[model samples]
Target: MPRPLWAGAISFGLVTIPVKIVSATEDHDVHFHRVHLADMGRVRTRKVCELDGEVVPQDESGKGYEIAKDQTVPVTDEELEKMPLPTAKAIEIAAFVDADTIDAVRISDSHYLAADGQVAAKPYTLLRKALERSSKVAVAKFAWHGRERLGLLRIREGAIVLHSMKWPDEVRDPQGLAPKVVEVGEEEIEQGLQLADRMTIENLSGFRAEYREVLEDIIAAKADGKPLPSPDEGGERKSGEVVDLMAALNASVKAAKESRGEDHGEEATVHEMRPAKRTGGRTAPAKKKTASSKTAAAKKTTARSTLAAKKRAGTKTAAKKRSAS
Candidate 1:
């Protein structure tokens, strides 16, 4: 059980539902501390006052807004807490909109909006069910972490999930920062699509963060006083300027098909029926098969034959049993 970060009521018209906000996600990245390399001792940092050159205790610190190079306006925690803000203790519903209309880029963080108590459960359930039926989300405003935040409340897995959003001004425009546009030929585009089709997988879980696993292995080896293993060399990729796009795409499709235990030599019926582009007088080059592809095809053929043999044997045994009866 995790503790709630906030306890408040969600207000929409006359309806007020008390809810507890809990974090919906957690960090899994590896963290490291600063240490003295020679002595392997931990390193610590301290805050000191610039005026008196004295170390400042945590309690002595205060927030300040710098107006000029040497001028700062000090603000107290009590004064900030007493500031007028309607969303300080309540989530005010601003509007309702289709959940799909919300851009993923605007979402910052997510939190679970759970009913605070038994008294609030009925209203919470009502709200969740209504959102599900309408496929709508509530745009809301609330004060959290000492600042006003924009959020969206929607039903997720039978519970109300709140997604903190970034204001329009907070999101940076990529007009000038984006990559240079590259004009792609129709043949190149078709080949690229074909390669993508070959590499597509229904489940994303098939892939893992292999580098993290390698790092863990290295750590384990050090703890056990074993020699570190050599890093595996990655396949060489041709530079964009020198590479033949169509050839690369064809090779990639062939490799992908072989990895999936499919025949690389046999043309896929779909590809034959729907030629990506008309070659006119020129015919497309034959796919160049690698040694690995040949080995994969042979294994697949052997497996099919073995399965057919098993089926035939099972039928013969059943016929024998029927004759005996």
Candidate 2:
């Protein structure tokens, strides 16, 4: 079992469930250290005192808050620990709310809340089952790292998981970050929805960090003094601006369906562009063919046919006279 990072009790009204916080996730990313290129010597950072120009030991360093220029208030860990905070040693439940009500941006880290002892098992299971049945998450307050933090308690796989959350004030408002308003056709929106449906999956278990695997391979090759592996030849990266939005959406939908091995029944229909006038000015409505113009064209065709027939008769009469003579 993973070692617990913190030991605490959940103060759920009158019930107190002792629990241990263990990391719910793990990192598999490859880490690198700085080294000198000439001799491969490892480079390290040393903490130094700014005023005395002396290297400071880890134990000698303490937290300080800067109030003004060159003025700081030093704070010790003992002082912070002794502060009057109700959630100093326990996760005090504030309220229960629907899980969807909490914004995703406020959620930060996650940890598993395991029962600390046999006595805690009953209450832990009670809370887990209650949350599972009610389908609501518990919002709690806990003190960690010298400050009070907001947390969400929810059930996952019959175990209670605590997700650290940011305070409302800590989250920034996206006031002007949205794109400017633009016109979009109904067909384009429908195509976008179709693309989303095509790409939807049941869960995220199939995904893996392919970049990390390739990085590990590169490191192993370097350590074994072997040639680095060449990259696979894939399709060329698409570049340039998208001139036609509807066409792009149709292509995206088709690509997604093909990737998922779905049936390609029919092609996406695009809106037909209206015919416009070809002039050195603003586009005008296309001219319609009138009945008078059609009648005039028919008369010209008849006159041409009659002239051709008369010439043919005259040529035949001249040939007959020459033969008689």
Candidate 3:
């Protein structure tokens, strides 16, 4: 069973509904060991005071904000309770807006909002189902813990999903990060897009936390008193044994065709391009399919050329040997 991160009451005008907020996400990133070089010992640091250079007790510590240099603005626990922000109990529904109104950069966290009391079930379910059916979301303001957060309330998976959002001023402009580029012609653009379409794949499933799995398996093997396989036991794989370029591309295109029920025989050259723009009643792109096809349709043209050269050399040598005989 999942645990609720927070338990509170949601308020919208006259309606007060008690709800528990549960986290909707988990992470499994690889964790690393902390080690030291000296005597091969692990290095660790203690949280200590900067000036006094001494470890502070957890109970005696208080929060502080540094507006300038190392000078911290000390805040007591009681003082923070009376601070200017609204009390962290109420969720104020400001408006109902389109679910698409919130952008990726604005989203901070996701949460599952579940009703607490049986009396509030009807209204809560009504709101949740209504949002789910209408394809709309509610914009709300919430003071959670000690911080103020702008949030969106939408129905996801038969339950209410309250997603925290960033204020408009907090979202940075994309123009600063992305630079302008020159546009290509429609024909060339289409070819580039088609080539890019060739490289797409399905959702990530084959990929796994390799190190984590290896560690876990090794641990299990040790616990069961079984001999562990050497990590590098499978020696280096030969280049010839791995999937060849042509075979891999063929398999990928075949799999894609099977899934999408598409049989893309060959890539469209410049002449075969759509929109059919022609000059002098003749296609310039059509003339180019290809002017160099006999020599260029190869996975490794250079390697083939080298092999052909070697074969010619052998033939010439055999001919010379026969003449001498």
Highest-lDDT candidate: 2
Model 1 scores what on Cα lDDT? Answer: 0.76
TM-score of 3: 0.62
lDDT (10s digit) by residue, model 3, range 1-325: 3567777777777878788888887654334458876676877767898789889888878889999986879888777656675436667788888877668789888888888879779879878877888888888888776678899898877888889999999988787576578665775555545444643444466476666555545554565586764665668657668664444444555554444434467643433323333477542232224447656434234433444465568767987897799
Note the Cα lDDT for every prediction shown: 0.76, 0.80, 0.68
Query: The CA-based lDDT of model 3 is what?
Result: 0.68
Q: Model 2, range 1-325, lDDT digits (tens) per residue?
A: 6768899899998999999999999775666789999999999999999899999999999999999999999999999999999999999999999989999999999999999999999999899989999999999999988999999999889889999999999999998999999988787776667666556654779797767666666765676586876887897647875567776766776665445444257664323221223356433332455899899556545544454465568767987897789
Top TM-score: which candidate number? 2
> Which pairs of residues collide in candidate 1?
none
Model 2, residue 283: distance off in Å is: 49
lDDT of 3 at 321: 93
Q: Find the 10 residues in a row with the least total lDDT in model 2.
A: 269-278
Candidate 1 regions with alpha-carbon error over 4 angstroms? 178-182, 235-242, 263-325
- lDDT tens readout by residue for model 1, 47-144: 99999999999999999999999999999988877779989889999999997898899998899988998999888888888889998999999988
- Model 3 stretches with alpha carbons more than 4 Å out: 37-42, 67-71, 82-87, 191-325
State how far residue 59 of model 2 sits from its true place (Å). 1.8
Which candidate would rank higher by lDDT, 1 or 2? Answer: 2
